[model samples]
Every structure is written in structure tokens, then in C-alpha cells.
Target: MLPSDCPISPLPRSAMLYCEIYAEVKPGLFSSEAKSQSSDRTMDLGLAEDHFSRPVDSFVASDIEQLKQAIEECKRLILELPEHSEKQKDTVVKLIHLRLKLQELKDPEEDEPNLRILLEHRFSKEKSKSVKQTCDKCSAIIWGLIQTWYTCTGCYYRCHSKCMNLITKPCVRSKVSHQSEYELNICPETGLDKQDYRCAECRTPVSLRGVPSEARQCDYTGQYYCSSCHWNDTGIIPARVIHNWEFEPRKVCRSSMRYLTLMISRPVLKLREINPLLFNFVEELVEIRKLRQDILLMKPYFITCKEAMEARLLLQLQDRQHFVENDDMYSLQDLIDISSGRLSCSLTEIHTTFAKHIKLDCERCQAKGFVCELCKEGDVLFPFDSHTSVCHDCSAVFHRDCYYDNSTTCPRCTRMTERKQDLPDEQDVGS
Candidate 1:
């Protein structure tokens, strides 16, 4: 449809319709103009104008551009995560927990040992031993898991070198403050070069070629003996063997000379020789205290006449205690008769002679021998014998013979050890 005013239009009615549709979809220009712009490489300005001008798609593209920007920001944040800071926070928490546990376990009342200490300060007094060329009074050895050896110039008694607990730092007793602790290369008593020697009791032979220290030649008899053996030979067993009759006397044995030598010598390993009978008596006391057995077994071994009487008195007391506790009280005469067995009168005589030395009451009379179970509540008791139980902590006592018949943990500290559990197929060997 060409108007008369419009110059001759070659377009058909369909082409005009197409142009109108195209302008509606991608507006702002005629189809011919749009095609001319696209062909000229300016892209279709009409299409861009139409896209910007139109209301954005509500259903399919709602806020899609904003969402994409947000997504990109999130990805960047993830890539730049602070991992080292998180790990440091975890480490800090763990360290705090460990410190708290350590604080809880700290014992404020414990005795703190000095971090740096000298050897002589710890082992001040010298211990002695007996050897042919050794000075019994000055011989000492250090005892430890790792040992060092030293030969005393004055006394040939071989000993551990570390036993010289030194006092470089002053202690309450400042006797060793003047001595130079660093002067260890030379022998203190003798000017001879210090050499290491091993005790006959604890000997270890090594190759001579690679010896760490200078080799020493001891002209000492190959027939060497330990301090214990020396004590035994010197009549430490007392009258068990009559000295001269049992062993031959040599021409070197001068009684006066022997007495003088003995006076100056420290009798190492001779605690029993000081008084053999006394040694036995102390041993029995320790045993009876540990094992509350009937004291009658000690009667046959007592060397002194006085000791026999004491043993009889002890047995009589036990018998008296048994009768009284069981409501079968003994008459005074019966008590006297029990105390007057062959050893009974002797016992009385001995007690009367040394009544001042003897404590009026025995250990049994004083409640020291028997413990009250009530005092040791909730604690375990390990019994050495029928009458005694020792708590591993606090040392609160119990008499198993007279009191509770059970085992448990210590009440004071609540310390306990879990024993291995019994299995079903295991046989009871004792039963």
C-alpha cells in the first residue's frame, strides 16, 4: 500500500508487517536501518537499546546479576581463608588444658631439692671396711647404679669414687668449705697418682691395652677377701666358736698389739661382733614387731641369762591376756607360777638387775603393737602376720588378728592399684 505522498515504495504489505514486528521486539530503529548498522560492524544498537530499556525478566532472571556478583565474592573469601589463625587458636587451647592439669597435680608442701649440689655435702661421713693394708676407719665406697672406682693411698680398700659427696657450696656444717673440690687429679692423702681399683666382691676384668685409666699393679695377695668375710673370721659370731681352740694362733698374734689395733680400727661389718647376743636380741625385736607371732620361739636362742627371763615374761603376758579376754581369769598364784617356769625366776632376776634399763611396759602394752581399725577408714592394710596391717599411706595401723578381716585401698591418699582380672578357665593353685 503506497501512499501518493510517499515516493514509490517497493515494499510489500508482508514486508511492512515484518518491519513492525522487528521494531516491537528490538525497537528504536527500522529493520533497514538496523540491518545497515549490524552489517557495518557496529552491532545492532537497536537490540542493545531494547535490552536496556525493557523491564528485566522477573521469572527467569530475577536478581541473577547481583547473585552472580555475590557468588564471586564468596569464592574469593573461601580462597583467602585464615587457616594459620585457626590452628594457633587450637594450639593455645591445648596448652591451657595442659597447664591446668599440671597446676592441679602440683604439691606445694613437697620438699624441693637443690638443682645444683655437691657430692661431699650429701655423703659427709666416711664409711669403713676391713682389708689387710686398709685403714678400717677411713675406708668408704659410693653406692649407685653407675659406679666409679678409687684406690685410697692411705688405705688400699678399693671403693666407688663418687662416694666423696663434696661440699663446694656451703651447708650448715661448713667443715669442708676450705677444701678445693676441683683438685681430683692427685691423691689427697698420698702424693702418688690416683688409680682405680675394683672391690674383690664386685670385680670386672677388662683388657689391659685399652684401659681408660692408667694401669695399677697391686702387690696384694691374690687370696683376697671381702669385708663381710673378714668380719666373720674375726669372731663376729661370738662364743659360737671358741677363737683359739677353733683356729690355730700364729706367732704374729700378740694380745696387747691386737687390743691396740682393735681400739684404733673401725669395725666395719662387725655390728654383730660388737655384741653378738645383743645383735640377735635386736633382730628378734624387729621380727616380732613386724610379725606378731607368739614370742616363745625366741627362748632357745637367747645367749644371756637375763634374756631367757625376758622371754618367759613375754609368754606369760600373752597367756594372761588370752585368759582375761576369754573370761577365764587366772589367780595371782597361777600367774606367778606361769612366770616362774625354769626360765621364769631367771627372768625375774634379770629384770630386777636391769629394771632401770627396761621400759615398764612392753610394746604390746602400749597400743603401738596393735592398731585401731577405726583410725584407718577406707584404706588398704597389708598384713605381714596375723596381728599387723600397714597402710601404704599415713602408716595408720591395723591388727588383722584382732580387727577387720578385709582388704581395701588407702583412705588417706585413696591410692589403689588394679590387679590383673581372673579368667574363667584359670585354676586356683593354692586351693
Candidate 2:
């Protein structure tokens, strides 16, 4: 490439030897252009040396270009080594096309050697690992086209099941009603719009049409409730708090501490004005208290009499008329012979009157006595002989002789039986 027409300089023998060695050692310097070689030699040597460097530069230029092309080819193959198989010729071509596109995207101002190297390294690493897109939640295959999936908005975790209740125990109503007709578009708890969210109640999409967003009632008295238990009146209370005698003395003194809500059509000021501490908070407290007192007061009657002279009083208004009945007629003669209402003395007096009224199989044997088969407690039996007698209250079989001697009733229930079936019409016999 360089011309051999410049003048040669007479230099020191050592300098001449050094110039020739530099020319031979570093061929790239001379291969680029003759002007460059001549200028360098002019500073380092005379006019004769410049002329010599020009010719030498031409010879090196061709060799250097060949070496440069070889290196570039080697770099290309290294970058495309992952898809270099003969069977993957199409892949190789595709990679080459991609490389060309990357080259086009190089920095215009700066040399893009680093950019090209980075692209080549990344492409090779991806191909070697056969990296494909997949969902982290389900590990399902993913393509670039799928933009939206069922993902937890809170954690950004994608999942297949639309609702989380598949593992957890959902709200009771949600378990009962798996697919709610009403699809909700918002989170009920937060009152925020959620297209993919589910109702905590039904575990299904909430609809605006069928299901109500808020519950009409709630199980918890003083707490916020989910939509599920709002309408359900009977909610499970903590047995520890409700049933513990130490915490609640009413439960042990009474049987239970269930608070029943009673709605009266006509709310009276007298009923409403009374402090619930003095009386209960219910509208019909006066009547309810009277009924309960009567029932408990007449428990001796219920225990002694074969027929339940005791009215079954319930705390709930709904159950008030459950056991109500018309009064039975009494014979006028029996009323005159025995002092009417004399049995209503002490509770023990009533018990004795009801016991004496019982018709025993034999006065001595006392075989025909009513007794619970399970507990041997109760009165109501007939004279069927000494061997076997049916219990009036329960299916207890007892002998006449054994009835009187057994002072203590059945250990289980402690209920005593009167040895006679109290006839149905006999309620007013001693009236």
C-alpha cells in the first residue's frame, strides 16, 4: 500500500537495526497506511528509511486484513455457538439476523464493542439454558401473549384457583353456598373495587343482583360480622364465656343463659321504662316471670302428680302457647267430700295429696307404682301383680313388695314414683 519513492537516511548502524526490528515486530503499524509509516520513520529515521517503510507497509496491509477477518469470523461463531449444530442451520441464520439487528442498534458516537459483546453473551446464555417463560405461582407454561392471570393483588402472586378457600375453611355460608348467584365486583371488607376478587361469604364472584352486600342481622351482639352470619340468628357463642359458672352465675343457678329477642307488636312504655336489672329486658317480662315462677313453684306438683298439673313455661314468647291446654272438669261430689284447693298448702302437702290419690295394686306390697325405667323416678302405675309392674313415667319394671321398702328413689334421677296410674279425669278428683 505504501509507495517506495521517499529518500533514505544514513543512520547509525544500531538505529538502522532497531528500525528494521520494529518494522518486523509490529506489522500492524505499517499495514494501515504508507503516510503513517512515512511520518513515523521521518521522525525516527532519514528520508531513505521513510522510502523503505512505505514499501514494507504495503506488504503488511494485506496480511493484517486477512487476520482481522479471521478474528471477526471467530467472534461470530463464538457468539452463535449454542445454535451451531448442523441440524440447527435455520436457528443459526435466525441468530445471525438477530445479531445484525443488534449491530444496527449500536451507539452512534462511541465504539459499540461492549454493546455487541453484551448482546452476544446474553443470547448465548439464554439459548444454553433453554430458558422459557413460566408462571412462578403454578409453574405453568407462559407465552408473551398472556397479559392477565388470576394473581393475588396484595402479593402479586398468580394462582389457578380463583378463591383461596380451596385450602382454608371458608365462612360457614360460603361452605353452604359455594356458588353465589350474586357476583361481587368489590372487596366487601375494604369496600374497594376488585374485578377478580371473591366474596368472603360465598367464595364466589359477588353479583349485584341476587345477594345483599350487607347482612340484615349479625350473630355477634357487639362485633362486626362478615356477610355470612349477619342474617343467621343462632350464632355459636364461646362456650367458655357462655357456659362457665364462675364467669356467669346465672347459667349455673338457672339452666342456660341464652338471650332471646322478642318483638312485641305494641311496645308499652311501662314495659320499656323498667330497668332491665330489676326485670328482664324482654317486652313481656312480667308475664314471663310469673309463668317461670309458677312452673318452678309447682315443680313438686309435676314430680308428684302423674299428670303434669305444672305448666311448661318457656322463656321465649314463641314457645308460650306450646303446652297450654283447657282446664279439666271436676266431680262436684269429690269437691264437697274433700276440701277443694286444700292440696295447695305447702309444696310437701301437695306432694302428699297427689301421692295418696295414687291407686296402689296392694297397700302392703305397693307393686303398682309409676317409675322411670332408666331412673326409676316418676309416678304412674297399675296393679299388674307383684312380679312385674310398668313404670308410669318411664319403662321401669318393679315388684309391689319392693316399691315401699325402697325409701331412696333411683340413684341416678332421685325421682319417686306413686304406685298408681293417675286417671286422666282424676285431675279434679280432689279439687
TM-score of each: 0.18, 0.17
Error of 1 at 377 (Å): 13
Worst 10 contiguous positions by lDDT, candidate 1: 237-246
Candidate 2 lDDT by residue in tens digits, 256-365: 11121111111211222223332433223343333333334333433444343332212212222221221121121112212333312332343333334344322422
What's the CA error at residue 256 for candidate 1, in Å?
A: 11
Identify the candidate with maximal TM-score: 1
Question: Considering only N, C-alpha and C atoms within 3 Å, which residue pairs clash in candidate 1?
Answer: 119-165, 119-166, 120-165, 120-166, 121-166, 309-347, 379-411, 380-408, 380-409
lDDT score of residue 321 within candidate 1: 41
Point out where model 1 deviates above 4 Å: 1-267, 270-371, 374-386, 401-405, 412-431
lDDT of each: 0.29, 0.29
lDDT, candidate 1, residue 75?
Answer: 27
TM-score of candidate 1 to 2 decimals: 0.18
Q: Write the per-residue lDDT of candidate 1 for residues 205-229, one digit (tens) a residue.
A: 2223424322222111122222321
TM-score of 2: 0.17
